[model samples]
Target: MSCCGPTRRTLLGAMAVATLSSALGAGASRAQRNSLIATDLELVTVTDRSVIMTWTTVAPDASGQPVPVASSGAVRVAPVGSAPVTMYESAEPTPFHYAEITGLEPGRRYIFEAESEGVRAVSALNPVTLAPDAPEVCGEFTTLVPPPGRLLRTFALGNDVHYGETVSGLIVGDFPPGFRSLPDLPPYPEVMLAALLDDLRAPDRGAQRLILAGDLTAEATPSQSRSVRAQLDSWGALGRDYLVARGNHDRPHTGADYASCAPATADHRDCFTEFFVPREELVQHEIGGLRLLGLDTSELDGTGGRIDRPQFDHLTGILTADPDRPTLIFGHHPVTRTSGATALAGPGFILNASDSTELQTLYTRAPGVFLHHAGHTHRNLRTRPDTPCDVEFLEVASVKEYPGGYTLLRIHEGGYMVSFYKTRTPAARQWSALTRNEYFGLIPAYTLGHLTDRNHVVHRDFSGLT
Candidate 1:
């Protein structure tokens, strides 16, 4: 699971996941039964002193009856050898709980177990640094380690989580038999993402921030959008440790036909922005000395994308604020050449020609901008703008389907390195392979690329950035 794997697009084919998480009162029979099936367990947020987790409680038998809560519910955590476990219980009886723990020691590891009434389950966040002799049944996670030196911070980048998009074909909005929906697969986003969270919780990958470049959901419906946003929260809250950019699919789509049905947006606007990038159409922030600029370069009801004048200007101001600060700007549309199914790419797969040229020019002028990452092509490709600048335009593969994984960006004092790490959990790997042939079997050729796409080196003179 640690090794990099070939790329491919996963068509959910067919999977049925309950659309709702929390239900109302429980049936009398369920009152005493521990029918709470907790899945999608995740550490939603973790800081030097606190951590938050969220998960779903599969509802009771579908007899149109309400599900009962456990007689008692609490998250139990303890050090490996510690006998007494610390339990944090929620007063609410909902299936969805954001279990929170605070005042934890940074870099300390703990074994966590969650239980409510009749069910007790262990955490899946196994530690990456446990001793071989350590017990294997317990769920373990360590608080994030603080960056040591001139290293301003570390962040993780992932994209294309099409929640509710069981059939990969619908995501591309197609009707070919190959793009037809299959009803025999497991939940696409849930299983793959569960495995991803499992991997992120490990000791070595405690990224301080997470940015989803775009395509946050299959269709922007309320439930799907809500669920996708919640899934992202399984890592951290929006505006804090996690943020999102809009994708062409994330625009305010509306149609009568299911295939054409687009996920609903906020104020009839784009929910992708509402849920994650609520503060601004484009986001700009600084971590230590490292700057991150997130832009929404997508269009409504369109398969392609664009960097609107407003967003372009917003980014311009951000880049101008600290031209010398090491910065990484990202969005949904690619800005360079792509491979595979080239005929199907159309204009939107990459930025429009005019904008592309202008962006390269802007990047060249801002030498501090070392990386401009994107998604949407669902393939991994790295381009060095071909201008008088070092800005590398990289397009990351989709995270929801085959080759399910993400890029880890480690920012050091002088420069930074990006390495693609595939999700290691059995479920993630299984599902990724299961959906590998999406888009008429051309996804593999387009989404996965040469080994160079998975690893990159950026040597910049950062002697001044301590």
Candidate 2:
């Protein structure tokens, strides 16, 4: 047998070449396999106890389904000095993905990954820290202490981003014939958010979080959802945590078949649940002895603009649970009226008279709820202080349309300060002018003018219990 055609050495050499070719071919095949394109990957917000993450897919899959990706992308979350990476996974069919990572240690640096199809594409490494503690990315933030005094840095609030929609028809009953499409508007929600974050990161000031009251999109469309998420991710890059709420637009509409409005493969609520609800609601973060309580006010259909009984009960429970903590409540709708009219009037109008009364009654009785932050109305207006409870209502401006801006809330030992910061970018300024021009005739004669107007006041006070 050894005396065969080729010598042993020749045969061995041929076998080695074949093995090499096989290995090379396998490697090429692996490389050719389709990848999970990652999009909208972002750290939305980070509180003292939780971190919010959200992202979307670049394209739909072969089944025409929006691909679902979790916190498994190129980003990984790790405690400041810890090595163990927290593993996050998504269920499936994700066009827009959102995850809330909880049980985080306060003021500790946490690293996260944003991977696409098993490949690490981007990394939000050591990107965020739990709230109540200052961030280490730019530098250390002094923990806010209680009364007698501590410097409370100012932060902004924005809601109803409503990307991808033409605002022309959204106002009143019909779209003006010559009106330009909202998509053409400059500094769309995404751009406005970027600018807002930049203003927050400006030198010499420590702006902590950007609270998004809700209605992140015009409707829960995949593209719209992705657009909003992308804007949020951009803000996260600046070390800002976006506290979000669910809005009427954030939910599925009942028109025709409910399925038509929702992601084809996932449940109707999946879109909203994936991108909005954080890991934990009822989050309590201390800003110098004052606690901030972010509540979920956007309820399912048939309950829009109104807090359901369960949520009402939950508010009472949380207040009773922590009676002593000076707390701020954040939601999509205002709890009181600006005038005789309601703050949220059904779906089309601002608050209705009855809706305001019901919500006010519930809020007045709740303890620890001193400051209520809202942003469904695009206008900027501060409500008269409520008696007994002494709660102050702040309706933040919208990011996508006219007078596009946000409200800055500063909490200190004596009390707090609230101011509206108008996005001064060219695009924002242009939109502000256009909206004023187009809606001038129709503008509510009673409410405050554009948020950018000089008369737009930054109502300040320490008399309220904080």
Candidate 3:
């Protein structure tokens, strides 16, 4: 359990549809009556204007025999004392039921009901909670309102989940002796991830959307990418509530010297793209009159980071279009060299100087580009350009290792503040404490934010955004 609020994981397990007490229909055959149990029921892809609910119903006879039965599923939405809207209905036997409802009005309250196997069930929890019901589900939910007061918007940033390696975390210089070779107890990435999500979902957290900076998988292999995406789908819908960027650890190549490999292309690859987000890897979106830009810095070699020309040009277009527009640019690698890495060569800490210089010039011109959030360094970093950078560069620690949490961005009309919150679930706190054993306990001193890294407030005259 989390100290912050009741977690989604608690609700997910609590609401399994098969075990709920509900009325049994009398019109069915004996086997039909015996086998109408629905399990693994939940909702995902829940946006302000839409939601997708999914579940699996196993119609097993009392004798534990698999019986073929025709099934249909649909979602209903309505206000009090009104005829409910049938948002979606389908008979596709994709081994489960997935129904979606769209075209909803934000900030309004509505009730949702899921019907499976011709039986309807309703849940007391809100649809945002996505709690299941007996052979179905119903809940009330209020769509998220636009960010309040001077705050134009809010987003949660997390990275370095490294979902599939199940082994050593990101210690990527000379391979440490007996590190990857040593056996891991088990994959604890999920525990850390669950904690992070719970913290993000907490009512006091106040993020309207989530953006993972990068390093989403461990090995950058196909299986790692697929596993990460699958887990994310269960956590919530990717495109609807959250988005991800690519990292060196998430590139399409591998080495099993720890046994690994990933087939690649000229400057781009499809492994991360095919599964994570179907849209272009480098893209920008405008929200609350501010632009949010995510960059893919995963290089061909997979160790260092670099931005290709195509993405740079695309970014140049955005920055030049209106250098005055308040924008947030995020990527996996830091352009400025990282502190606390005294043992490593200077080159290892950041992208090459030429790449850094090009961006520095752009940032100097784009006065409204106030912040840059990055990952992959797996350490908390706050850096500013030497040329009187108005832009505050913020780099967050990894999600799967060390301090193990994420940063929250609160953008207001006057200015913005960036705060780091450690994922505070019992499971996360336990794993975070245990995982400090990583890198010979040196990980905590640096990866956990020190002073300026965790909480930094910047004041600017951005009242013009209104």
Candidate 4:
């Protein structure tokens, strides 16, 4: 999840003032409390030395929909027996709160409490109780140990950009109202994509390479593909500095919108193949002793995926040739069987069960293959299959909606670490906050994974890679 920047907090504060004033004016004619209430408190991220928290403050409205109330937000945090240090946001009052507690000790347990305008917050684990002397325990976490080894390279891995799409959470055949970008704001996809690139550009982010796993566009329209390509071009050179895998949304389509695009291997025209993969072949890149493989997991006219015989054979050949090259594979659909029950798109959300099994078996042969990156589920999840192969199936959240950001893969000589970073641009953070209400306000529970899922380290002998 995102921590709102100063500009975002300032804007939110202004909006809160207007909303609170209007609510008070109308409250004279109705019955309501003038106090603030904090809800949806989440412990978003915790690392060796820091933790991030977020929540919302709302004013009761007669319409039953709560109005955002601008109140100063603060979090009190401490070790089990240490004096607490209070971290506060900017002087501005914002309904949305993001507080980061730093200088924490690794492997130590910490407790935290959040409040706005003197009103304590309620979290999923905390309920409303009338007792006045309640222990202010909103949540607690044990910080993790730092990853071993000297940091080598940091690469940004993200997916589900969904350019050219206007709405979010509209599953096929479940056509209720989905979330839309604020009418007065620019398209959320554009705002978010730009912000993601900007964040990666920052020197502190230290991203040497970028990989977008899939869903670069909404419909694989020629224009949509070109637009996403242009944005990526502004960041770095493709093939050399960045790479992309085709997503289900970027599959071939039979329509006039794609009539002028190059003919696809399938019956329909495919703009994605025309631009990114004219040969329509699998991708491989050797970077500083690391082998990166990009798989085209998209099926023609279907959301599920199956590795065709040709692609599967190609992968087998590559892995068999250098079975100890320290490889990483990326695609759009995750191994369905490993994705667990949180896959919002149902059983077909990923590669078919048969394909998933075959792929896992293949991994057992390639000892150097350490990770598989995927992104169709739009949620942060890290799962390892039941097989004996020591590989991680890491699925990242979407870049265009709630929890908007990418994951950073920090390679080291002794091991590697993967941590999610929410885009910090003001516009990006605002859009991220606005879209948090998607999926009937259950989006956070589905997307904001536990701290370990968002940030963790693995011990491996990566000393071979330069």
Candidate 5:
């Protein structure tokens, strides 16, 4: 239970659809052609006075097949009893659109209609409503109340960069086809990462620091690790401005391409460790009096994660020494199962059950550890463990594929807010839209979590953090 205000999960879960899966599979098809249709429209980010909406435009192709097509985008927003306002007139046509509606009054409800090439977008009838039901209105959402107290810090959290991979959505065993970038275009990973950096540079999204939770590379090859490192260095001074955690794909590999590197656990070569964690130890850093703990949860040979004895002991000592210090933990694998992850891959997709249980027990002793950020499973989910502690386990979506983006953590004196942002660069948006069909079109249902999961406010007293 939350020690602050009302339980956020309970309140939000009450408005959730009974079964999102059934709605996605059984809902009536509202297909159309001969005109532009905006699909997958979502309120990606909702702040106190603004919301970022994203969608893909569909139009008839050369073969008369309805497909994602480039088109100008705009939105009509109007508060009740007020005239509609048009915003976000794109100068260039793009198949993928990100529309930011700003200048909204806090706590005011507004009706919105997203349009492209004169065709208005309609929300898919789903069991769960992203906002309060406005039956006759096209779409409606209430802006949030700003967190109380002075704003102190902002950080960008992203992961699953997957630097060297040419293909995405490839799983072992017989699965649906994977996707690759257009032959003449740059790799999808590079396109998305560049766009992420560009977006982070915006004044409104000014991120003082960055934390890439895991999966820094497609494979832990020396070349791949070096290339990824160079790219990150282009953004900021590595150890001071950004930190990285290891994911399953970053674990040492035994492939012949890495035969020259030093051996790691078992027969694999340790290129990722050599480049990222030269000291081969867990890292802890302090910024503005806030402690950041980076954990390497990758195992030697499997997708499941486990902390080494030494690293676990070090974490225990650190937490025991400063039980009340404001802290945020970042790692590759989630410590608990998220609904989206379970619906997609089952228990193996997260940290091993035993390790997760032990960590939860540890969290019980640390009152100031409020959030644990993780990647892997390529989804957006926020879950609270059944343990007595009040910490939240947040899983961010991938930066290298569909729904490509990161989450912004805004720390205020009295509380904090988290909002997920999809990469907005034109190329990045295109790649994201193309990969939405991953896993046989089941990705959206399992990866694009409920609105509450992606954007929400958590009240906590952190005035002492500096």
Candidate 6:
């Protein structure tokens, strides 16, 4: 009675064939009738102009592979209205399939579906729109481009999304002796990145760029690297481009293990660079009229962080070359304070002050250097020039830790608005409460009364620089 069922004559023929095969005790014909199973369906947006669709398959027999016999499976993309849909045939072997669909319009919604082997399977049919002209909302911030004679929008930034490690141990390697706490964070980088993309796509304000600042993975392990790459691909699918900087965690550290795992430097870095970095030397974009420069501060050394001579010179040259444009420099580590050292504790965890000063000197020389965006200290803190300028040193909070959040900046004709948003996860909130308790419990009696004062005094304002 089913639509795909055999007709009377076809049924009779099948019965005769089955009877003959059974009489002969053949097993091959019976095995051929089994159904196929599909698993691990992934849909990715490769760029504003394209979407990459992929999935995995588990075949009945391992000897052969899944192949498209004809133009059977079709993926359709349509607009919000009753517009005519665009359809494309899927190419195989789709066991682990990847497809790049192009010619999409920016800021438009679309839908897709797939079918196979007389069985139909449909996805959520979720509405996915093309990325907007500005940085779409992600976390607490909307992106803003500074216009001529306007107030500059400042960003709280950080990168190196090496999640999945716990306080007790790393899921992939040995934990550093000094590592304090690591609780289970949500979505890891993939889910978090998706949420960020969704936020950017929201009808609200968008960021000029997330200024990834760098090292989205713990190391360039095949799995870890792939996970990070997938997140970037997803960002692109959402029609956003990340200003990816280089970080120590992204490249292999110098050690026997690193050498053994990564046979070639180019290959190792290529795994990440190919997907994240827009260019080899510099990645630049315009927000309003301001120029945002993402610099690669990652050095080959396995130590803390540094900018090699070439990169330093390159930064200097870029700034010198474009004297007229207001510049915002983004990197993974703060140039001024490598680690906080000289507060009551005497030395906090942040960029070393000497290096910080050195970098500050370079920035100060250029009147156009409006802000320095960094993340290494997982705390939300801001600093400005002791001497005075339109420049500010803004450190963003980590997506994985206590404050577990991001900063949003709004640039307008007069000045910019800055606000921080904590990660709105149930688990993160619980950990935040625990962190506060631990902070109070560990401090000395004298320090206890001053804790609130010290915390409140850390933020800075840079409207004068603009």
- Using lDDT as the measure, which candidate wins? 5
Top candidate (TM-score): 5
Q: TM-score-based ranking, best first?
A: 5, 4, 1, 3, 2, 6
**Poorest 10 consecutive residues by lDDT, candidate 5:** 13-22
Question: Which regions in candidate 1 have their CA more than 4 angstroms from the true location?
Answer: 1-152, 169-186, 255-269, 278-280, 337-344, 439-442, 463-466
Where model 4 places Cα greater than 4 Å from the true spot, the runs are 1-33, 61-64, 124-138, 340-342
User: Which of 2 and 5 is ahead in TM-score?
Assistant: 5
TM-score (C-alpha, index-matched) for candidate 3: 0.62
Give the CA lDDT, 0 to 100, for residue 422 in model 3: 63
Q: What is the lDDT of residue 327 in candidate 5?
A: 91
Ten residues in a row with the worst lDDT in model 6?
133-142
Superposed by TM-score, candidate 1 places the C-alpha of residue 349 at a distance from the truth, in angstroms, of: 2.1
**lDDT by residue (tens digit), candidate 5, 123-203:** 333223323342212376777777899989998999999999988888874356777775557888888889999988799
* TM agreement with the true structure for every prediction: 0.62, 0.56, 0.62, 0.86, 0.88, 0.52
For all candidates, what are the clash counts?
13, 28, 4, 0, 0, 29
lDDT for position 385 in model 6: 59
Task: Give the least accurate 10-residue stretch of model 1, judged by summed lDDT.
Answer: 7-16
Candidate 3 RMSD computed on C-alpha atoms after optimal superposition onto the true structure? 14.7
Tens-place lDDT per residue, model 3, 1-466, is 0012234532432343222211111113224444454333444333345554554443444543433234677778875456677878874643245565777875676777666656552321233232232112335544444333387667888888888755554355544311221123346677778777777777767687788888787765667777778777776777557877777766654344323332355434446666764222575666667778888887766467687787888888889989988888888877774432421434565666677778878889888888888887787778766456687778888887656778878776766666676665544543553454455434544465443456555776667665
Q: Give a tens-digit lDDT track for model 2, residues 410-449.
A: 6654655454545655445334433433343232222233
Scored against the true structure, residue 180 in model 2 reaches a CA lDDT of 44
Q: Per-residue alpha-carbon lDDT of model 6 for 1-466, expressed as tens digits? A: 0112222422232222222212111223222223343322224222224444432222222333322122134445555443435355555333223344567664455554434453322211111111121011010111122232443554434454664333311222452221234234344454444444455534332554566766676665556666667766665631145566766566554444344453435433234454455323566677556778876656554525665566667777877787656677787765543234422222333444555566677766677776677665454556655444557766665554433446555554444445454433333433332232223222111111111111121123333344
> How far off is residue 87 in model 5, in Å?
3.0
Model 6 stretches with alpha carbons more than 4 Å out: 1-160, 164-195, 237-240, 254-271, 278-280, 337-339, 342-355, 386-389, 425-466
The alpha-carbon RMSD values of the candidates against the true structure, listed in the order shown, are: 12.2, 21.1, 14.7, 6.4, 7.3, 18.5
